[model samples]
Target: MENNQEGILLTSAEQSYLWTTYQADTMAVCVFNHFLQHIKDNEIKSLIVFALQLSEEHANFIREIFIKEKIQIPQGFTESDVNLHAERLFSDVFYLNYIKNMAKGGLVTYGRVLQNVYRKDILSFFSACLSQSIELNSRAIDISLKKGLAIRPPTIPYLEKLEFVHKQSFILEGLGRREALTGTEVTNLFANIQTNYIGTSLATAFSQVCKTKKAQNFFKRGKEIALKHIEVFSSYLKMSSLPVPGTYEQMVTQSKDAPYSDKLMMFHFSLMIYSGVGNYGLSTAETQRSDLVADYTRLNAEILKYSEDGANIMIAEKWLEQPPLAANRRDLAKG
Candidate 1:
């Protein structure tokens, strides 16, 4: 790493990632504020506050970078997007799990950004972000474990001996001849199931409080897709005689009160949908079984369509922020 990285202009990767991080952190601040208002458990409250602090700090840090470069800072989520007095829509355990999943997303995002960015300040920022997400993720797990609410991944029996695959069918699908699920395959399958579980719970809650019929219908569709994805992922685990993880639907409450604005909720759901798509893509790559690849490919397409519909909703609502783009030489020449 060069010490004079600041002299170099920000790469497209650096600018776009910082831009996205600003939006996500700001949204997180609003969410934590709303969560803080209704949390009765002191331990969970402190964790929420810690998570909020990181988001606030991240936003401020990115704002300084934008200002120094004369880039217009995005008007990300604000206090207007959250209603502090809204009734509780989630239980304490649900709050913890949400934050855990949130940190999981942040880790993946920051890691991806770090790989593409080289500017010194941006590198430092994302490095710190990655570290903070690790801490936040650890704390969430710690709290969950202490409270006996952690969702553990399914376990497979330990390998008793070194083995080699004797058939090309190890990578192929057949009528009745298939190898057992590999550990990596199981890992991806279980992780996808867990992510979709969170999505299903959020969809359930978001659908309950959305004011517009359109948004409500969107969330209901999302919930159905999430539930279906979970079922499909769980089938693989069940085939290996592993116990499939259950849903977090019971973590949600029946409250009809809206804690966050429709726009904020919509953006939040979009973030989850995008992350879920990435998870599926990664699972497709790491998984060895042809059946798993086929399933992931099909489900990935389903969510991509859902994501496009969600983006259209946000654009219509004027809630989607435009990212930095390339200059149009044709338009410039015409002008």
Candidate 2:
């Protein structure tokens, strides 16, 4: 709320966005670098290069802003988190899909950040990020479709007449056979299935490449959890006679070579877990079926526990970076 000769001071929301973006882009640099190691297809390689460039630029921009504000820069993931000399752990197709998924995530994240930004400079930066993510998402989708890897959702018949729900049975699932899924419900189910599929494959790859026994075991458990959630989501579509999206788990290689440090892998996996919780919560709110809601609630609870366990592990190893926090007035007074 205060400004100096330097510039307008950062609000808590603005500060949070900058800090989170800095950390995410730092991890993106390491991730794309590792992806570049095994990429054989020129098309996929170019996409990865573009993504890496954006991440680097964003990281630099945030670094300069932090310097101007005199805030200590976060020690985010860096080249030390990755090994370019490592063997290929993922196929080229997987690289393409990973970028596609990441672009989708970026779109959601940048939109949220844009809403929180109050300063003109910060708004402009996030606006640029949002535009870039839109273009990146389109490119990724085009490439995936061309490569025959895109798993589109099922199309429904056009509604001839608009009608409102009359009976309570419209939202019921306990007694009789449930009615057909609404378009919104179908979309969420398909989206969550896709998310879990990617999570499972990424976790599987990390489990193999992670350094310490603890990290490896953690990834293995994450993979199992993701697989279980995928099954649950897929079954809902199956019950509706809808086609389920396929996974890219087979794209992961048997290489045990470490492409990234254990700390980086753990942090990346934790981010995906937290994102899944958000997605599932949205899905639950959009659905009307009691059974679907119950399933999402149960899966969300499971992932919350898993995410907490991961945080504890990161804390034990002192790998978790502390976010910006308010000063403890009581502690200062005591001192």
Candidate 3:
């Protein structure tokens, strides 16, 4: 063993975290390689090929770190274990959708990891990963649009800045009383918390599986966003003296069973994103009456971006739920 004490600098917690992340990245590369062979779309296939190379490289680097640290690395899922040829039996549309969904999960994970790490080397590693993730996601988004696979969310016109008169009479009257939360408000809060948990868990898993330093760093940043959301929700629960929900854990893959198909995974995540946006909107509306309106509004805006990205992936996969459009409105008017 190379002098174990000379260059190994990560703390035990950091080492363990890196090891777990590396294992996940190993699995991700295997899956992407499988995707590369199975996908027929030349553009998507090219993108996956590039992504796979990046993932494999990162995996090797993490393995090197483990070797230097005298740590035993876990053997995560790999292409050898999965039936890529068998998966190819499925439609090309399904395959593309699957990769896109997995990418969204990865985006979330990189975001979180970036938030938790403080070391210069670790931070640099995550930053690079984040950049790659953005590039990959951008490519996916473009493909989805060109292929007519993207879904668009409802958008309202942006209003120019306008000043409103301040009113303090109501604030003065209710200054001493603690406001009660309505049932609808409580329900929305619970839903938003659940959505954040799911999003974060998926993101963390993606980061763990993606192999490039750029991608891993991106995953770290995603992890941070999820953690922050968790804190925000937990604080609210605490103020109400409610118990915090358990941390969301990734579903374990069975030794015998194939992991979730990519299409299904993307569809499931897209739903979560949509639900999160709706819940946030409701929460923001309710908070309008509270002193925390500014805080909730900021959070809502951040989550909205996440939700929009999720919707875009769904569109790329052609898995979005049905919604009324202008044509439908015109038909209804004619009727």
**For model 1, how does the per-residue alpha-carbon lDDT over 188-234 read when each residue is reduced to its tens digit?**
88888888988889999999998978789999999999888888888
Q: Candidate 3, residues 1-335: lDDT per residue as tens digits? A: 22234564776445655665575566667667656655767977877787787678668767776687676665554555455554332344544454555566567667767777765666666677778778877887788789986543223235579956365523332554345444445445554555566566655554444334443454455557767877876676567655555544434111222333443344444445554555566577765335445556777687667656656654665544333122458778887
Candidate 3 global Cα RMSD: 19.4
**Each prediction's Cα lDDT score?**
0.88, 0.88, 0.58
TM-score, candidate number 2:
0.96
Model 1 TM-score, 2 decimals: 0.96
Candidate rank order under TM-score: 1, 2, 3
Candidate 2 per-residue C-alpha lDDT over 120-179 given as tens digits, one digit per residue, 9 for 90 to 100: 778888888999999888988888898887878899899999998777777886655466
Q: Cα lDDT for residue 205, model 2?
A: 91
**What TM-score would each prediction reach against the true structure?**
0.96, 0.96, 0.49
The 10-residue segment with the lowest total lDDT in model 1 = 1-10
The lDDT, on a scale of 0 to 1, for candidate 1 is 0.88
